[model samples]
Target: MRIEIIAVGTELLLGQIANTNAQWISKELAHYGANIYHHSVVGDNLPRVVEAFEQSRKRSDVVIVSGGLGPTEDDLTREAACEVFEDELLEHSPTMNKIIDFFKKNNRQMTMNNRKQSHVLKTAMVLENSEGMAPGQIVEADDSTFIFLPGVPAEMKSLMNDFVFKYLTEKYQLETKIKSEMLRFIGIGESTLEEKLKDLISKQTNPTIAPLAGEGDVAIRLTASGKNPEREIADMKTSILERVGHYYFGSDSITIEEAVQDLLVQKSLTVGSAESLTGGKFIERIIQLTGASSICQGGLVAYTPEAKQRVIRVPKEIITRHGTISSKCAEEMAVQAQKLLHVDIAISFTGVAGPSSSEGHEPGLVYIGIKVKDAPAEVFHYYFDGSRDKIRQRTVNKGFELLFHKLK
Candidate 1:
C-alpha cells in the first residue's frame, strides 16, 4: 500500500518542535510492508491543511495525519477533513461523556472550548483515547483510508499499539514483512568500502544495500521484503563480509565502545588509558556503559608536558628529545599507564588538535599508542582535518577501533 504522512503544526515549521510523529509512523508502517512515498508538513492554517488533505487523498491509498487535534482555536484538522471529504460534523456522545467524567473526577470546571474535542466527522469511525481528551478518527472514502491521530508522542504511540495495528492487519490482510539490518565498520573509509562491494550492489534486486557515513565510522544497511527474509539477508551479509570483514566491528545499535566492553568481558581482561590531547575522553566512553567498574582501571588526563611527566610519569628525556606529539612520547605514556594502573592493556593519545600550528607541527597531527602486558608498545600516527572538537572526537573513536581489533 502506498502511504503518505502529513504533519499539521506551526511549531514544526518554526523549528520549535520536531516532527517525530511522522518518523515513528513511517517506521511502524514499513514493518508491515507498506510503501511510504512522501512526508509532508503543513502549518495550522485551515486552507493549507485542506489543500494537503486533498492532494494526499487523490494519490495515496492510505493517508496518516498527526497533530492539530486539541481544544484550542488552532485545532483545524477535524474541520479541514470534513471540508475535503464533504462530510458533516457531529458530536460523538460517548466521547463527550468521557470528557465530562474526566473533569468531574479531577474536580475542575469545564470550559466551553473543551467541548470542541468531542466533535468528529459524521461518517468517520471514532477511536476513544484513553491517554488524552481528543479522540482519533478513521474515514474510508473512494478506496482511500484516512487515519487522524493525536500529536502527543505518548498518546499517539498508545493508540497505535492498542487499536491501529490490529485494525490495519485485519482490514488489509497484511502478509509480507519488511526487515532491515545494519552492518557497522571502522578502520575503513566509505568510498573504499563501496568500491569493494560495487559488483554486489550493482546486481541487487530484492535486498538493497545502502552505505551511510556516520560520525567516525561507516555503515551498510540491508533492507528486504518477503514472508521470511532472514535467510536471504544472512546470505547477503555473509557475501559482504567475505570481502571486507576485517573492517567490520559490529551490527545495528552496537557502538564501538560496547563492542570493546563485550570483548573485554569475554577475555577477562582489564583496560586503562593515558590521555594527552583527548583529555580522558577515551576512558570516559568506556565508563559510560554499565558494569564498567569491573574492567576499567581509570585514566589520567595529562594535557601538558609537565602533567605527563608528573602524573603519568612519561620520561622527561623523551619529551625533551621528541616533543609531546611524537610517537616516542605516546609509547612512553602507554607503557607507564599500564605499569601504574595495573591493567592488561593500555592506550595513549597525544595530538595537536588546533587551527594553529604547535611546536612547529601542523594541526590535526596525532599519535596513538597501545601496549599489552609483557608486549612491546605499538604507536599509530594520523593527520586529520577539521575543528578542534572533531579532531579530538575522531581520536577517541580511533582508539576504540584499535582496541576492538586487538581484543579480537
Candidate 2:
C-alpha cells in the first residue's frame, strides 16, 4: 500500500518543533508493509492544505494527516479535507456530549469554539478519541482512504494503535507480513559498522539491512517481507552477528541500562555507582526499569573534590595527588562506592565534559573505574568529541558497555 503522511502546522516550518508525528507514523506503517513515499508539512493555510491533500490522494492509497483538528481558527485540516473529498461537515453528537461532560466534570465553562472539535465529515466513520476531545475520522472517498487524527501526539498514537491498525488489517486482509529486527551495537561507529557489513548490505534482496546511528550507539534494522520469512531472517542475523557479535549488546528498543539491569537480575547480583561527570544519570537510567530496585543498591553523585572525599569517601590524598579526572581518583571512587553500598559490583565515572579546559585537561577526557567483588579495580581512559551533554552521554554509555562485557 502506498501511504503518505501530511503534518499540518506552521510551527514546524518556523522550526519551533520537529514534525515527529510523520516520522513516527511512517515507522508504524512500515510494520504493516506499507510503502510511505512522501511526507509533507503544510502551514495552517487552507488552499495549501487542500492542495497537499489533493496531491496525496492522487498518488497514494492511504493519506494519514496529523494536526489542525483543534477548536481554534487556524485548525483547518478537516476543513481542507472536506473540500478535497467534496464532503459536508456535520457535528458528531457523541463527541459533543463527551466534550460537554468533560467541561462539567472539570467545573469549567464550555465555550462555543469547542463545539468545532465535534464536527466530522458527513460520510466518515468516527474513531473515538479516549485521550482528548477531538474524535478522529476515517473517510473513504473514491479510491483513497483518508484518516484524520488530532495533532496531539498521545491522542493520535492511541487512535492509530487502538483502532486504525485493526481497521486497515481487516480491510486489506494483508497477506504479506513484514517483520524487522533491530540489532544494537556499541563501541563502534556507524561508518565502521557499515563498512564491516558492506558486502551483506550490497547483496541484500529479500531481507534488507539499514544502519541507523543513535545517540551513543548504532543499530542495524533488518526488515523482511513474506508470508514466512523467519528462517531466512534468522540466517541473515547469524551471518551478521558472526562478524560483529562482540560489539552487540541488546536488541530492539532495549537500552543499555535495561540490558545491564537484566543481567544483574539474572545473576542475582547487585550493583552501585559513584558518578562525577554523568551526575546520578547512571543510576537514574537503571532505576527507570520496573524491577530495578532489586538489582540497584545505590548511587552517589560526587561532583567536586570535596564531595568525593566527604560524600562517597574517596580519599582526599588521591584527589590531591592525581586530581579528580585521573584514573587513580576513578578507581578510588569505585572501590569506595563498593564498600559504601556493599554491592557485588561498583562503577565510577570521572570526566571533563565541558566546552572549556579544566585543570589543564581538555574536554571529553574521561576515566571509568570498575570494581568487582573481591577483585582488583580496573580503570579505562577515553577522549570523546562533542557538546557537554554528548560527552556526558557517551561516558555513561561506555560505562554500561564495560559493565555489560564484564557481566557476560
Candidate 3:
C-alpha cells in the first residue's frame, strides 16, 4: 500500500517539538511491506489540513494522521477529516461518558470544551485511547483508509500496538512481501565500497542494493521482494559479507557500541580508556549500556600534559621527544592505562582538533592507540576535516573501528 503520513501541529513546524512520531511509524510500517511515499506536516489550521488531506487522498491508499486531537480551540483535525470524507460531526456518546468518568475518577471538573473531544466522524471506527482522553478514529472512503491518532507519542504508540497493527495485518493480505536488511560499516569510505560492489550493484534486480552515506556514516540496504523474503535477505547479506566482511560491524538497528559490547561479553574481557581529545565521549558511550559496570573497568581523562604523565603515567620524555599528538605518545598512554585501570585491554586517544594548528600539527590530525594484555601496543593515525566537534567525534568513531579488529 502507498502510505502517506501527515503530522498535524504548528509545534512541529516551529521546532517546539520533534516529529518523532513519523520516524517511529515509518520504521514500524516497513516491517509489514508498506510503501511510505511521503510525510506531510501541517499547522493546526482547518483549511491547511483540509488541503493536505485532499493532496494525500489523490496519491495514497492510506493516510495516517497524528496530532491536533485535544479539547483546545486549535485542535481541528476531526473537523478537517469530516469535511474531506463528506461526513457530519456527531457525538460518540460512550466516549463523552468516558471523558466524564475520567474527570470524576481524577477528582477534577470537566469543562464543556472537554466534550468537544467526544465528536468524531459519523462513520468512523472508534479506537478508544488507553493513555489519553481523545479516541482515535478510522474511516474508509473510495477504497482508501484514513487513520487519525492523538499527537501524544505514548497514546499513538499504544493505539498502534494494541489495535492498528493487527487490523492492518488481517485487513490487507497481499501476495508478495518486501523485506530490507541494512548492513552497517565503518572505517571505509562509501566511494571505495561502491567501487568494490559496482558490478553487483549494476546487476541488481530481485534484490536491489542501495548505498546510503550521510551524517558521517555509510550503510547498504538490500531490499528483496518475494515469497521467501527472510531467506533471500539472509542470502544477500551473506553474499555482501563475502566481499567486504572485515568492514561490516553490525546489521539492522545495531550500533557499533552495542556490537562491541556483545563481543566483549562473549570473550569475557573488560576494557578501560585514556582520553586526550575525545574527552569522555567514548567512555560515556560504554557506560550508557546496561551491565557495563561488569565489563567496563574504568577511564581516565588525561586532557593536560601533567594529567597524562601523572595519572595514566605516560612518560614525560616521550611527550617531550614526539609531542602529545604523536603515535608514540598515544601508545604509551594506552600501555600505561592498562596498568593504571587494571583492564584486560586499554584504548587511548590523542589528537589535534582545532581551527588552528596545535604543536605544529594541522587540524584533524589524530592517533588512536590500543594495548591488550601480553600484546604489543598498536596505534592508528587519521586526518578528518570539519569543525572541532566533528574532529573529536570522528576520533572516537575511528577508535571504535580500530578496536573492532583487535577484538576479533
Off by over 4 Å in 3: 161-163, 175-178, 214-217
Candidates 1 and 3 compared: the better one by TM-score is 1
Model 2 over residues 324-379: C-alpha lDDT tens digits?
99999999999999999999999999989999988789999999999999999999
Model 1, 1-408: lDDT tens digits are 888999999999999999899899889987888788999999999999999999999899889898888999999999999999999888899989999999999999999999999999999988888899888899999869999998999888888888888888888888888888999999899999999999999999878999999988899999988887777789999999999999888899999999999999999999999998898889999999999999999998898899999999988999999999899999999999999999999999998999888878998999999999899999999998899999999999999999999998
TM, every model: 0.97, 0.80, 0.89
Score candidate 1 by lDDT: 0.92
Between candidates 1 and 3, the lDDT winner: 1
How accurate locally, in lDDT, is each candidate? 0.92, 0.91, 0.89
TM-score of candidate 2 relative to the true fold: 0.80
Overall local distance difference test of candidate 3: 0.89
In order of TM-score, best first, we have 1, 3, 2
> What stretches of model 1 exceed 4 Å from their correct place?
none
